[model samples]
Structure formats: structure tokens, C-alpha cells
Target chain A: MVAKRIIPCLDVDAGRVVKGIQFQHLKDAGDPVQQARRYRDEGADELVFLDITASVEKRKTLVEMVQKVARTLDIPFTVGGGIRTLDDARAILSSGADKISVNTAAVQRPEFIAELADMFGTQCVVLAIDAKRRLGRGNRRAETGERAANVESDIAREASPTGDPEVWFEVYTYGGRRPTGRDALAWAAEAERLGAGELLVTSIDRDGTETGYDVDLLAALAARVNLPIIASGGCGRPEHIYEAFVRGRADAALAASIFHFHRYPIPVVKRFLRQRGIEVRP
Target chain B: MMTRILILDYGVGNLFSLMSAIQREGAEPLIRQEIPPDPCFDGLILPGVGHFTPVSERLRRMRSAIDEVIERGTPILGVCLGMQVLFDRSEEGPGQGLGLIPGAVVRLPDSVKIPHMGWNRLHLVRSNPLLHGVPQGAWVYFVHSFYPQPEDESVVLARAEHGVSFPAVVGRDRIFGTQFHPEKSGEAGSLMLKNFLRLCRG
Candidate 1:
């Protein structure tokens, strides 16, 4: 059996890793390469560098950072964010990233999934789905409380078999701020059909909250897609990882804040998972 | 003595990390679209991670150079899709392979989930230089749905079970192939590459 992957995500802002990165003895969490090497050694199955600074020239900055990280680590590295064109994908992969994750670009141009799969092989392309929980009767995007009256009919809303109004997760774009009025489950099914090898399903409501993974959402998407599903966002504890694998049935779990702040180093997390028979890679 | 390794980039997959890994093992790594007219590298590396058909077309263009290097008995190591292209054909693609080795690439059994994208334990089928410094049952990273089934089983150097028992490593004389990406396999991978470098220098 393949071991369940434990991944730590690094949020990159103009080539530097940020977001709760300072803590303990690891003073230099700013350098992406050093953090990458440390995580790789600490038993991270793969590392994701999410480029938050969305700009034209920052793409080049992301590429340069990928080159540096690739030189220092042997583990699989993934780059996400601001990749809108094939040229953007090309520049990043050529710089040595093992995979590139696309969210808004893939949603805007769904054909972009197959195009990437056709050019770089399905294994190197990861489709990122930012899902927000729909918790009310109002037809609006989650968190924003804005009206999505016109776009409501665009996504199917199934009433529960018991006849009560059902809640479904809607896919969000542009860092989960803009609503696409599309169900993430439907999008995942289409993404697999479009040749995406993996799906990184993130719960926007749970992101940066560390309440725990939206296991309910993760479970829902995992059942819908044939590709490997990486559960991202709201992972504050090692038990969250265990739940993602055993309960949510996610192939991998990704966390950022806890690891960056040194609350739980990767090796300790792996050990925790292994003790519970999660079959994590050492 | 340093070993010079030529990495053939056919406009498919990532090869930068592979190049850096070779350099870390104390070898000179060079990348080119095609085999140079007068190639001087001690070893040849074919690294890829995409569909085998396009890679087969690219290798078809460099057939003569590849054959000449084989005739010269220079070491060649193919990784992942690079390994699959060494065979005569693959079920994943339409085109035929280089036919350097007598074999065909087939998809892993449906019983297992693919792309087999995780770390697996390698079971050595037979003794080979590639496993020189590596331990028995060492864990290596793999990310492919199809594995090569060599016509001559004697060429199979190591086996890793996925759904069907598949060959993880294959070799015949100076020619070799690894289904997993050694460049990403960490210490065990570095040891394997270092051993390959030694053979190239020898």
C-alpha cells in the first residue's frame, strides 16, 4: 500500500515564505529553499509553494524561487497560484517544480486542464478547488454574504431526500473571494474527466482557522473523484491528519500554520500518524 | 575522475531536478534537445514524466545517436517514462519505443489505484550495481501508472508490488532503467545515482 502523504504548505509572497513562519529555533523560515530542505528531511511527502503575490513579474520571481528550491531538495515540489497560461506553467516546470496547481485559471478556462495534461502529462498538473460551505437558504456566496441571485440557477441545488433544503459546497475563485456558483463536487468530477491527475480540495471557511479539516467536504469530494485527493485548509492538529486519511479518505493532508509556527514538526506528526496505523512515509 | 552525463530533453516533463541530482553526485550534467553530433559524455540520462508516445517520437529522432552510444557501451539510465521508452512499445501510447531492450510497457493492474503516486518498498530481484550501496527493501518514490515488462526476465533487477508484481528496476549490461524517480527518492536514490556515476567513470 502506498503511504498516506503528509504535506506542509508554504505561502510565498514575492519569493519569501510568510504567514505565521516565525517560531522556536528555526529563525530563517523566510528562505524557501531552507524550509523546503527541512520539511523534506522532516518527512513531508511533498511541499506546495502557494505564490500569493499575484503580479506579472512575480511569476518570474516564483520561477526563480522554484529553481533555488529544486536545487536544494530531492523531494517532489509543487507551485500554485498566478499560473494563467501555458507559458506560465512552462516557465515554472522548466525551473524544476515537479507539479503546478491551478485554481482560478482552471475554473475560467476549464479546457486549460486537458491542455496542461496534454503538454505536461496528467501527473504534473494539479487542479485546486477552493470550496466554501453553503450554510443558508439565501443563494449567495459563502463568507461574503453578497447576493448571487442571477448565478444561483447556474449550479444545481438538490433538496435533501427528506425534503429539507440541502447544503452544498460551492466552488470559489480568486483566492476564494469570488464565487463561481459551481459545486466543488461537480467540478472535481469534470476535472478528473478533463485529465487532471490530482485534486487539492480546500475549504475556504476552514482555511487559516485550524478548527480541523472540513472532513465532511473532503469526504464528499473524495467519493466523487477518481484522482488522488489532497485535503487542504484548517489542519491544526495531528489528529486532523489522521481523520483526513481514515475518515475523510483523503490520500494526503496539507497544513501550513501549525508547522510553520513549530507547534508540530513534521517528524512528530508522522510518528503520531504511524502510532495510529495511518501508514505515513517515514 | 568525473563522469559527464548527457540529459536528453524532448520538450516533455521536468529534468532540472534530475540534472541537479547528478551534479550532487559529482558528475557533469548537460541538457540538449537532441544528442550532440559528437557526444563526449560518459553516460546518457533519459528523464521524462509525460505520455510515452511523444517521448517515443523524440527518441525516434535520436535513434542513431542512441544506438551509437549503446554500441560504444556508454552507460544509459532511464527514469520513469524515460524507462518506459526503452522498450519496444507501451499500452499507454500509440507510438513504439526505441527497442533498445526487448520488452513492452504495460499499465499496472486495475486492482491498484494509480498513478501509484507515493513511496513503495523495492524488492531486489537480483544483484546489480545499481543496488550496490542501497539496502534490501528500501523505500523509493514512484509516480507512474504503467511499468515495463521486459521480454527477458533476467534483465529485471528489482521488483516493487503495486497491483500486479511489476519490475521496479531493469538492467542488462551497461543499460538500465528505474520506474521510480531516483532524483526524488532521497538518500537511497542518491546512492543509486552515485553508483551509476561510478560505473560511468569506470
Candidate 2:
């Protein structure tokens, strides 16, 4: 049997690592190459580097940073953000990245997914989705009170209304600012049908919270999709990883804040998982 | 005479980078689309890229040359697409391979991703002279869609994972195969090539 994966995510902007609370107020973390080496040494199963600002800036990719990290670390790393064309994907792979994660670009051109899989193979392309519960009726009063009417209308246009305002999650793109008004589960299934090798599902509400993974959402998505699900968001404790694998049935779990702050070393996390009867590579 | 390594080229591999790495290690490497029928080199290196179906077809066209070299007991190393061609057949395309090794190449499941690209750590399953000094948990670079599923597991030297490990490295006497590219794998990859040269010298 294959062991579950423990991954560390690094958000890169202008060739630097940055972490933010719920994708807002970004702050520098460190040099990407250095952070990548640290995660590898600490026993991270794989690493994910997102050029968080590439799309908005309209660039190809952070080639130099990716090359530097690839040279420094021996673990598998996936590069995401601003991968718009076959040429962009090829350039990243040639620069030494093992995999390329496509989100907005793939959604914009579904044929690009098949082209990537056909050219580089399916395993090399990962589809990342940022999901949040839709606003419900119960939350309408609080939402209106919190924001001006114009802003509230904008939010309403972007987010769907769940029967109960308190219980909805909306799909967001452009670094979780633009709402796509699509259900997370439906989008995930469509991505798989379009030949996505893996799905990196993230919860906007729980991101950077460090409370725990959105287990209910993860389980529901995992149940519906046949592709491997990478549960992201709010992985604060060691036990949270095991819970994601055993309970949520996620093939891998990705965390940023706890790992970036050195709250838990990867080897220690793997040891804990192993002791709990989960097969983890030592 | 110095040992000369011939890198069989089918115009499909990233040979420029591979050839540079070989030269960096102080080894003589000759890139040829057609191996000389007389088997002139001390050892042979089969380097490949792209899909297996086309690569295998090219090998079939050069069958006589490949057979002559293999029969001479000269050590051979196959990398990535080169390694897949050693199997009995491949589901990658129309089917049929060199049959140098017993196995079949199949598509990786959608659950694990098709091209298991990246730097993945290897788990050594058995000992082989070709892998001398290579640590059990050493990491190597990989970029491929179809993997070798050797019918005989005994030849498997190292295994790595995407969903489940097939075989990262395999060896049987003088012939060897690596699903990962040693030439592009940095120091560890260079060391592996050196080890193969040493095997040829012995």
C-alpha cells in the first residue's frame, strides 16, 4: 500500500516566501530556496510553491526561484500560479520542477488540461481549487451590518446564497478574491472528468486559522471524487494530519503556517502518524 | 584503451544535457542514432525521452545493432524511455519491446497522476553492484508517464512512489535500467553513471 503524503506549501511573491492570514495582509516568510531545503531536511513528503502574485502581475513563472529551489532540495515539488500555456508548463518542468499545478488557466481553457497530460503526462499537472462555504440567510444580517450596502451587493454577486446564510462556501480565484459562484464539489468532479491527475482542495474559511482541517468538507469532496484529494487549510496539530488521512480520507495533507513557523517538524509528524498505524515513509 | 560509452540516440531524448553531464564526469560518450553493428564501444548507454511507442519503434529498426552489442557482454544502462524499451511490451502505444527484460509498461492510474515527475526518494529493495555507494533513501529526479512493471521482481533494485512504487532502478548482470534520469539528477545522478562506468571497467 502507498503511504499518505505530508506536504508543506510556500507562497512566493517577487522571489520571496510570503504567508498571510486567509490570503490577506501578506508578509514575507523567507527566501524560497532556503525554506525548501529546510522542509526537505525535516522530512516533508513533497513541497508546493505557489507564485501567488504571478497571475495578477501577468508573468510566465518565477523561473530563477524554481531553479534555485530545485537545485537545493531533492524532494518532489509542484509549482503553481500563472501557468497559462503549454510553453509555460514546459518551461517550469525543464527548470527542474517535478509537477506544475494549474488553477485559473486550466479552468479558462479545459483543453489545456488534456494537452498538458498528453504532452507531459497527467501526473505532472495538479488542479488547485479555493473553496468557501456560501453565505446563508442567518448570516445576512451580520453581513449587512458588517459591510456597506454596495460592498454587500458585490459579495452577493460573487457568492451563492445557501438556504441558511451561515452555511455556504463559495469558489474564489485570483488568489481567493474573485468569486466564481461555483460549488466546490461540482467543480472538483468536473476537473476529474477533464483528466486532472490530482486535486488540491483548500477551504478559504479555514485557511490560516490553524484550528484544524475542514474535515466535513474534505470527506464530502473525497467521497464524490475518484482523483486523489490533497486536503489544505488549518493543519495546526500533529493529530490533524492523521485525522485528515483516516477520517477525511485525503490522500495528502498540506499546511503552511504551522510548518513555516516551525511549530512541528515533518519527521516528528510522520513518526506520530506511523505510531497511529498509518503507513508513512520514514 | 579508455572505456567509451555509446549513448544510443533516436532524436527523441534530451541528449545535449545528458552528454554534457557524461563529459563532466570525465567519461567518453558517443551519441549515435544507429549503433555500429560490430559493437565497438566498451559499454552502451541508451538514453531516451518522449513517448515509448515511437522510441520502441526506433529500437526495432536498430534491432541488429542493439543485439550485437548486448551479446558482446558489454554493460548497458537504460534511462527513462530507454528503460521502458527494455521491457517485453508496452501499453504506451502499439506494443512490443526489445524483450531484454521481462515486463510491460502501463499507464499510471488517474488517482496517482500520469507523469510521476519530480525528485522522489528511492527505497532500496535488493543489492546490486551498479548501485554501489548509492544510499537506500537517496533522492533522484524523475519525469515520465509510463513505468516499467518488471515481471520478475527480483531484478528490482530501488522503488519510489507516486501512488505505488513500480521500479525506480533494476539490474540483471550487465544490463540495467533506471526509470529516473541519472544524467540530470545532479551529484547523485552523476555518481550513478560513474558506478556504471566502473562496472564496465570491471
What are the TM-scores, per candidate, against the unseen true structure?
0.93, 0.76
Write candidate 2's Cα lDDT for A147-174 as tens digits.
2343345444423333343565545677
**TM-score, cand. 1:** 0.93
lDDT of 1 by residue, A6-109 (tens): 88998888888876321111122577988898888888888999888857776678888999999888888889988899988988998899999999989888
For model 2, the DockQ equals: 0.17
Best by DockQ: 1
Candidate 2 lDDT for residue A112: 81
- Clash counts per candidate, in order, are 0, 13
Residue B17 in candidate 1, Cα distance off native in Å: 1.0
The best candidate by lDDT is: 1
Each model's DockQ score? 0.65, 0.17
